[model samples]
Target chain A: MNKRENERNPVETPAHDAAHDALAEELEALRDLFQKELDRAKNAPDDAALPVKDGAPDAPPDADEGPVCACCGAPLTDADADAPYCEECLTQMRTRPVHAAAALFVLAAFLLAAVGLYLFSDSAAQWRQLFSAQRAVQEHRLLDAADRYGDCFLMNADRDSVSLTGIKAYADLCRSLGDVDLAALLVDARFPGPLLKLPWNARYRALLKLQAQFAATEQVAIDIFGAYDDYTDAAVYEDVDAQLCALRTDDTYAPVAVEYIRYLLMKAAGKPAALQMQQLEQMEAVDDGCYTGYYLAAMIELAGETGGPDAARTYFQTAIERNGQDQNAYDAFVRVLRRQPAPDTAAIFSVAQAAQANAPARGKPVWLRLFAVSDLLRGDDAQALREMQLYMTACYEQQLSLTMEEWNLYALCAAAAGDEDACAQIETALGSAQLKLSPVIGRVRAGTWTAAEALRKDGGDIA
Target chain B: MNGIDRVIRVLTAPGVWIRSFWVHLLCRIWAVPVTETRLFQNKATFGHLQHMAPPTVGAAFAIGFVPALLNRLLALLLFLSSLLGLFLFRMTGWVALSANTLAFWFAFSLYVNTYPPAEHARRMQTMLRGQGTRAQKILLAPGTFCCAVGSFLERRGVTFLLACAGLAALVLWQGALFAAIARWLPNLEG
Candidate 1:
């Protein structure tokens, strides 16, 4: 810490001394490795010496000289050999190129090979093609998709087969095209493998047109008959008929499906009553009864020909047994009873009352309104008021439109029941409309919608 | 060992086989001159100096002989194109001549990369005052010149003959350097 010490060489300081000690340790380690190298050299063969200035391989050894290499403990090879290392030690110590550079070269070569494989391999190309084809399908690029798909299939077909996904995609393509010929061809190529679970029967009726009889499968028959809706054009009648004929032999069609098929055929061909009855009997003999209120309503066409209201009553009972929620069946049965020569007034009233109690909040039976309105028409003021109150309350809760006429009927029912308060609520909602005798709601469309065109045109003004 | 000792160990670790070289350079204590170093090392032994002279001569001869051998080998590999102009008196003789010229020029560049070691060795030796004997130069100069020639011949299409010639000379140069090392470098290591 004094000036004298400060002026001295830094190497003598504590820190420098520690560094020197570390350096000595490093040298000692290096020397150990050098010693090993020399020992290895000495064990090789008899030592050879270069002819020195003395011109004598057997020159007299210097008395003061000792071993040159510390480890070998052998005599020095030359007169002034001051090197601590022997020949082998020097060989081992030769500097080598940086290993990181060499390793980088190797890694680069490996990546180059990987990139080459991806670029040039057939499988990689096929994978890319398949990917492009899928992209094209998503973008609705049908031509590009077809081209890429064709290339992909051809690429694989030469050696293997299209994967299950590829086959499924082809099936999907056929379905999307919806051309009978194309569907048949592609479906035949794909089959039960891809279609085994995917709307099998619907797709079959659509794509399996080769035999026309494919429609006959109970599944296909169901799909064909059920195919008609406001959203889709009806399936071909010939296809439906062929499938129906086929379904007669197949036992898979449930009774409801057969009844639906008969209903469709009756509507399609305007078949005789006897033919429909025969079909209904055949349907009734099939799968456990699946007839619902919809089916019973369809059966209402045969009502006058069969056992009259009794037959419809039986159908309604069967429908209730099959699907207890068929309020439409309940409504239809009440209608049939009310239409009878000597109407079962109590039965109709009770059926209407029971339907009101049974109706769910959403999709309540369409005929519940029918029964209430029919009761009103029959002048059973108390029962009509009760049923109509239940129906109108539901209409309000369900956000269903109650055509202007329906509101007036509700108001009339309330008046008949002497529920001035209920009539007041309706009048208030209508903004003081005095047209309580309006016949706007004389009939309703099975309660599918409550709003009639006039109410919409009148901007929902019940008045 | 302090830091100085560590540095000394590293500098000396390659084994100062020719320790006298350092003393001659740094201590201003010169070894026998290039000519007399070998002679004076065994000046007392009459026959010892005699033995050294022959190897130097042999090394020079071998150095010269190597290039000649390489030249002939190249001649042979040249598809005997070099001989075509010598014998064929055809009107198209100039064509083969031109081709031989182009081939030699192109093939010479193959040695451009191989010349640096000889040039570096010579430069280092002169810088360190450890110049070897004439025999070393005899070995080094031809390869360096051939590499120069080869580099100039770039884009002429490789002449396998000249390339082989340069490589052979390079090998000869290495051999000569080794001989000179044993003879003169004994006292030059720093």
Candidate 2:
């Protein structure tokens, strides 16, 4: 059957052979070309192996043979290997026309946004005015600054940083211009609650109000309290004695008189003790019920300085007799006792016990701390630790920071109790505050010294 | 580049991309033909434009001016809002705190990207030098000067440093103000 078919289609057979020959020849030619290109690529230098331009006669036969430009499909040079596009494509892209409609759309959007923001949000304008005010202040243009600040205050009443800072700055400017009343008014109007509670702000307003009530000649007395509040130069208080005497006649200014006298007594480091005692005496004579604990405390301090430990003891007895419930008198007596070369721990413990029994809830931390100190002095480490724990707890409950001496005593007690962790923590706390354990406490922490040794060093009898 | 410069470039790469995006976007808005936009490695380039005419003063000024203004406005808004959210809103718990922190980060990023790139600033300088009215030059002079200075500083990474210092100062000032108020105010937790 095949022979018959071949015989019937003899012309078709030759034609098919001819077509096959042509196809084979073409395949052979392609194979040879590919081989030659592969050879050339192998023989080429590193630079020559770079991406050849598309349609170039010397282009690599296969696209996958090497890296090519992402944009143009040309083989990339070694230098351009890291680059996604060839230099030509990059150049072409650089010159490409931007979409005009899209560009206009974006431009319109931005313009609309700018306009919308300017119309809707007044913050930008307020901030600009605020900056202008700050600049005016820098240039000493107080009036312009004040005006700008006034504008700011009217613009925003929120207690944000900008508003608060503006309020503070405006008040400062008003004060600088000698318009204390205006400053007070502005602060009172703007800061309703917390800001007015600050000591300086309260004092500033008080001074202004008091000055308004008094004549210009009597303003100096009000100024004295202001100066004292501000910690003005001590020389300003040089004639404070006469000032207090003048202020004492007015019952309204009696508190001021008492405060100045207390200041004089406490800060009278270089001044003669006799002068401070006389002032204290004057305060006592004019005293109202406000002359409770602080008066007795100050007198005890002065008495210790003037008449020795025995005299201080006598004053303490008198103070206790005057008011056994006053925590400050007991605190002062214990402070005086502790300062002695040989502190009477028994007496301090007894005094602390009495103070603790009589002290108000607010005054409990003071007595607790004194008890701990007395226990520490007596070398009763366990009792001292227990007392200090109570003292610290009481202080924490009251939200009070420990005084420097209290911190020292706490650390010493911790060391005497062999609490390394507490000692380390205490050290860290003190170190962060730029303070260090006292030398005796440091020795105790290192285990080189004992509480008895510390007592002996301080001339205290261990018994 | 030195190691520090390289690190700074890498760190500021996102800021550079943001700035370039603004410039390109603005270019399109002005109908200026941009050839290409390339963001690779630590570099970002918005291709040259086919200026149909001598660049207008408004176009030149707006190209750098608008983006810078927006960046500052956006940053300030974010910063103040974050501060308000943290303090005023009295938002408690870690989630609100985290959100506020993220806002602060975004605000700082925007502040760092406030200045245009050196190329955009150069383009601005060229347009400013081109023919324009005397009044236009006087009006745009400050903007031009600021762009030049900002670009100069941005190249040297000084703007990044300045942004950091400025953010720190803002935080410290706000913290001090809030702390002072909080000291006397009733407990927010309650």
Candidate 3:
């Protein structure tokens, strides 16, 4: 206060007191001016910090009853203005109930859940159909498999509607069966346009084309050989004679062309074996050495008995040479070699070793198993056991479902190697001694059988 | 005094008796029901202001509709003013060198406007701005509280009914304080 300031300064004399009083009054005026400036800057009203004019209840309370906010004094004359108090201050005084906001949040949440459930239902039904089709296929009901798969095509044949789950399920099933061409035949006859709209539809088309050629070949084979169980089981036997003439025309499908040619050779029988030989030469000229090509080469030797020992040897050698990364070519060529008169153990062992050398270069697990059998036939017990172990490990790595016969064959390998521990591992891995076995496997188990019996009865098909 | 003797003394002079019974309460601001009670010696000392106090308080509770609401609005304005004054830069204006000047004036309006009679109004103004008796200060508490309650009752729905109830309670409460204050009137006049 100015009084306090005067006391602190201690100015003396009437003139000094008068000067101090005058200065105090001046300072007081400046202080008031500063305070007014501060209050105005803060948007505080003029009387905002003032009390009622004391001892004057007689004075008019509102003076004139003009518009002035009785609360925070913002002007109320402009557009969107409110009197008595500004709109913001007045709203602060009133509280609305919270239940309306709570209702909105719940409604929003329910709508979100409804949308999510709606989107998921379509894909979920598609998945369920695929699973049931797999179940039917496992049950050996081919008609049911085709029907369920057809239902899958109906759910979404549109490219935009197809999901990764559908494509992956189809691809995995085909690859797991290891018979893309035949399995496609069993699941089709639906004209496949919708299936063609699917991802990886090319694989399906290729296999399907292979399947058609195979059907044509089967028809021709049935006409010549009669409906032998080995030749025909899934199709009509009587249609064979009606379809035989179709084989004379050149087959367009690369996969089953060899089979079609073999049937043509059957149709050409006694028409001078030279003509049949010329047809085989022409087929070989166009061959690209896929698994079908090498298998057809071996089949050519078998179809002509007079191709002789050297010709048989040449075809088998060439088949093994043209095998590339696939396991099937070696399997077919070796099977024929094992069935050879005075079976060529040395040549088969050399071929198996060369294929074994290709093992690390993306070679198939089936090649290792074939080599193990080759090693066993060559009487190399340790090499056979090692290759067999490698084959089992490779099967496990590839998630290949091995059959009971393969399990029994592993048991035989263990027995031949004289390793009790290896035999116990096979039993433990198979989880039961009462495993399903083919009769040939039962004969091998009885210890009165040959290695050829175990090798040739590779019994995954029955299981 | 002993408890029984004091109780008897209070019972004799009903005006002072009612005032003294509230011993620990220590202050009396409201004028007693002067015409209704035997003030004996205190009645002779009555000035026009003293005579008007009780009637004025009764009329105040009855007439305090808009005034009561205005008093509450004043209190709200005072609070906002004080909040700004505290938070903002504190360099002084000539009039605002001291703090709460608006609040002091608002409370002054509240006290004066809510009392409704000239005499009570004057005394209410005195009590707000100047340091008065301990009794005067204590009585202001209920007086302000009654004003606030009466004010809030008129803020929204069922205004007439709730305001009437609030006013009735305020009148009775104020009458008691007035009675207690009146207990020493004769003594003060001497």
Candidate 4:
């Protein structure tokens, strides 16, 4: 491998030739990118021409000559005042003792305008980029967009009263990117003043609520937002509740409503009247409003918080009355009713009637469903068995999806129904199969479940 | 020689030489505005610039006059609020301790007038020019803790109990340290 020998056959040394070829290709690619970028730069609308020294169009190009300076197009020379300026005009312009102050003012104005335009264009570009990035999350692109947005804010710190139309989009983009904390920080900065007054305050509240639910930070949330009624009381008088109520289904509003409810409970923690109001409002959902059963169940729990056993029973009755078609609500109401020493026996009978009537068609299955299991623990074996049949019919007949929790509930119902053989078979199948018991179920088994007292237990060992 | 003459000679001689050396060194260092410099090319300068109080009260005081009673009161309030927030969040003593440290630095740097801003600026310029860098990331700075503390205290309902107690301890310890150090080496300003 002598130097002369290697140089003698440039074509024969395949490896070296290939290496050089690769380098050449890489350089060509890089050059192409640069060319493309340069073309873009050239094509970009030139603002520099907008405010010319005298605000007049530069002199036209000579018909026979190459492109010349639009201003004072005496034969353009590289050494002329503007370089592209005509010699005669260049000399005249230079001799005017270039008013340093005037020139500086113009320069300052130009720079200011340029900076403003640059910032506007950059922000617009960032918003567009963020939109596209969110549509299909590319982490690096999103991060780049975030950085650009941050730069814009930092650069324009002087304009503290900037609008947030673009920033909202940026925050939303951050949310989509799963940078919730960053999105929140941006929101806090960009959305100035008290958030409670915004039209989208409800939605913001809803989002905060959802976040609270997801993060289990409801207590902290309550501390920050104050009581819902207190916050909403004045607003409600102004028909704000109507607006908020209308917004309930808006993805933005749903989380806020849930949050408002949670906050309401927090605020009413020790106040009896406020606590009752929380129950009453929730029961209104159960009574004649849409999606009242969930509210009714929540109300019952809230009632318990107030330590009003009678109020809890009344709310449970209201829940059953509002949705007799929902057997689960009827059953839950009955179970809660049974726990109250001042039980409404008449309501229980009526609820049982509704349950039996609403029981699924095509007969129930052999496995005890969770509803049925709850019945058994509530000292209602017949209702429990009936629910078990419904579960089996849904699973075996309708081929409905049954999670491990459902399966376990079914197995328990079977064991409670004194079908030891059936219970053993279900248990063995469950144990052998990849029946993933949910954390809730595992916690229940381990005596660590939230609101476990609401879950009726007590079943014998499976055969 | 008289005692006064000896003292004056020592003071003037050292001060003149040091002042001349620092001025020459710093004039070259601060030739360029720091904000225009890139972070990577001037890491130390960037760090110092970034951490440079963005013309806030603390920044002004740290390099300016001994913080007035009002400023100390304000700083004390902030220090207390930071501690209260930590306590409400059920944080350990460390957070409160950190907040107290912030208060002390504010008092020492601003109230007690340890380092003059003019002197500090000159020193910084020299360091910046020599090393071509600023401070570290401002977010990871003691200044952040101070700012956070100040803001926390400014919020409605935050008291100054914790801050005042911390300030008392800090002033005492600082005085003791100054006295001890002065015995052997003498005071720079004196």
**Top candidate by DockQ:** 2
Candidate 1, DockQ score (0 to 1): 0.01
For each candidate in the order shown, give its overall lDDT on alpha carbons: 0.43, 0.59, 0.45, 0.40
Best by TM-score: 2
What's each prediction's TM-score? 0.26, 0.33, 0.30, 0.25
Model 4: CA > 4 A from native: A1-293, A304-310, A338-350, A358-387, A403-408, A432-463, B1-190
Candidate 1 similarity to native, TM-score: 0.26
The residue-by-residue lDDT of candidate 2 on A242-336, one tens digit each, is 56566556545434344445455345434666666666766666543233344567778677668766777887887666545456677777766
Question: Could you tell me which 10 consecutive residues in candidate 2 chain A have the lowest summed lDDT?
Answer: A6-15
Question: How well does candidate 4 score on lDDT at residue A321?
Answer: 52
Candidate fnat values, all? 0.00, 0.03, 0.00, 0.00
Which parts of model 1 have CA positions greater than 4 angstroms off? A1-259, A272-274, A289-297, A300-305, A357-371, A380-390, A399-463, B1-190
TM-score of chain A of each: 0.34, 0.43, 0.39, 0.32
lDDT of 3 by residue, A1-463 (tens): 2211211222122123345678999999999999998877678665765557779966765655446544566555543232344445434422222223323422332333343234335344654565565554443333344456556766656423343333433543443334455346433533336646676456556566665765665555645565443323324333442344455465643423544445454433433445445555655565432224424553534533456446555655554443333344455556656655556777677656665564443354666766677776776757777877887788888788787756766766666566778776766766664654345544555676655555544433111
Q: Pick the candidate with the highest lDDT.
A: 2
C-alpha lDDT of residue B50 in model 3: 17
lDDT of 2: 0.59
Predicted chain B of candidate 2, TM-score versus the true chain B: 0.71
Docking class of 1: incorrect
Overall local distance difference test of candidate 4: 0.40
For model 1, residues B24-44, the per-residue Cα lDDT tens digits are 121111111111112112112
- lDDT tens readout by residue for model 4, A331-356: 44545554554545565555555554
